[model samples]
Target: MKNNIILSWIEEGVVSIPSFLFSEYKSIGLTDLECMLILQLHAFMEKGNSFPTLEELSNRMTLSLEQCSQTLGSLLTRGYLEILKGHTDQGIYFEKYSLQPLWKKLINHQLLVEKEQTEQQLKLEEGSLFTIFEQEFARPLSPMECETLAMWIDNDHHNPALIKAALQESVMSGKLNFRYIDRILFEWKKNGIQTVDQAKQQGKKFRSHQQKTKVEERKKGGTDTVPFYNWLES
Candidate 1:
């Protein structure tokens, strides 16, 4: 008897509900009862009953037929549901429900949320970059310096982290000026260095080359120490 019941239950099939509907329905301004009605409608549509009567829907839920009708009306008014007309090959016309608007609202809401998150993250990064620059320079940035920083990010599309790395490189070379930092950025760009690690590797190579040149200079009896890398020369 239990095996028969299980088999019958399996034969009844299952309704596929989008996972986001459960989590985000409330955010999209759907009340719990309205969302439940939508789920019931989805189940009926999935089972090939595109237009279940309110009596049939109410039979499955605690709501009365009139309540189901009113809830469906609310869904229609809110643009979350639509009644679409169609015709069969026999030229018979019928009305069916379409959940396309509901799906569109969910998708558009998710995209808007992601866009907001990305914008917030960009603002935080820009703020932190400015703070780091001010701390390193030991003074507030001038209006022109601020404009240059914004230009590097907004116009030149340089990564803030990569710019920070360039500033560090300038500091290490004892040149803590905007022009020196700009030169470092330009040299890194010319060398196709898009990341801080790549810039560091390139710096290592330049230092090695400088060391080899100094050795050759020593052999030629030249004794002026090449202390800092001149990115302007590079």
Candidate 2:
């Protein structure tokens, strides 16, 4: 008998609510009561009751029928709920509730929030990149230099880490200047080196070739030497 009762309860089914609605309702300008009312409507609709009466809705909650009607009116006014009217085969008119507006609002709000977070993160990264550039140069950047850096990121679409790698390469080669760093960046792009590891590998290969050339020159009794890997020349 208990198993039969449990099976009957299970047959009654459950209401499906979007998990995000619980967390993000307030962000989309819905109060607790309004959100709860929406949940009740959703439950009723899921049970094949498209338009549950205010009395039926309020019977399951602390609200009175009048309060439920007011809340429904407010939801319609605020574009969170919509009543769709249609006719049946016998030309009978019927009204049903649609939660589409609410779903759309929730999705749009989430997208806007994600966009804001991405912009904030990008701003923080840009600020740190600028500070690192100033420290490396040992001076505050001029307006033109600042513009150039912005151009590298915004227009040229260079990654901050890649730009920093180019700067380091310039410093190591004893050519600590913007023009030299630009040339390094250009050569790196030309060679399809998007990562610092790839840049390091390219430098190692060049140094190995230079070492082989030096050994051959020594055998030929020539004593000329190249001190640094000049990216501009490459």
Candidate 3:
């Protein structure tokens, strides 16, 4: 009864993984068994085994039912496996397993790696723009805030000089948040205000108008005077 089942299956087929997965997934903290679990899920997909039960999975490997359940739970918790609901040919809905989360993660990790490589390439020539933000904001930047600043510099084509100018302008105007700084940048770009000198000249004009408005309100003896620093509109 213990005929050559192992030899027969070896003669039947084999599972293959992308060569890059070994290094990349491991670099991202997946252990050997975790990677094998992913590969086994792929094998189940290849066999059209929609929802491989714990017993079926346990039969394929040396793991017990509880071990298989725990491994699957770990994968789910780590966001590598997702369950999908589907309909059978007879119009019955059932749950199936998917490896889409892994693929999505691969794409994101690839982008993050590429970003790091680019930063390293430029490190010798340029200082970190993130440091400038942290200095101006007077606190350590969160990961999200660092990413946003990186996007502004790398993706939005914002040069550090202009960004620093925006920061200074925001501080001078008593508005220091990213939203106000972004609005200042947008207004400058819209009005063709390129240099700090141009921005200063524009500020002077705004102050002149504001003073004139205040003087007129005073002449009328109005209790409410015009805002002294209304350059934000300008």
- Candidate RMSDs in Å, in order, are 3.9, 4.6, 14.0
Off by over 4 Å in 2: 1-5, 88-92, 138-144, 151-162, 165-175, 183-234
Q: Put down candidate 3 lDDT per residue, 1-234, tens digits, no spaces.
A: 346987788776876667667778877668788888788888888777867888988888888889999999998898988999878899998999988888778778889999999877565223555677788888998887777677766787665667777777777777778877777777777888877788777667765777788888889996654443433555
Q: Report the number of the highest-TM-score candidate.
A: 1
lDDT tens digits, residue span 31-133, model 2? 9999999999999999999999988999999999899999999999999999999999999999999999999999999999999998888778777888998
Predicted structure 3, TM vs. truth: 0.49
**Which scores greater on lDDT, model 1 or model 2?**
1
Clashing pairs in model 2, backbone N/Cα/C closer than 3 A: none
Spell out the clash pairs found in candidate 1. Answer: none
lDDT of the candidates, in the order given? 0.91, 0.90, 0.76
For model 1, the local distance difference test gives 0.91
Error of 2 at 143 (Å): 5.5
**For candidate 3, what is the lDDT?**
0.76
lDDT of 3 at 231: 34
Question: Which residue segments of model 3 deviate by more than 4 Å?
Answer: 1-11, 14-16, 125-234
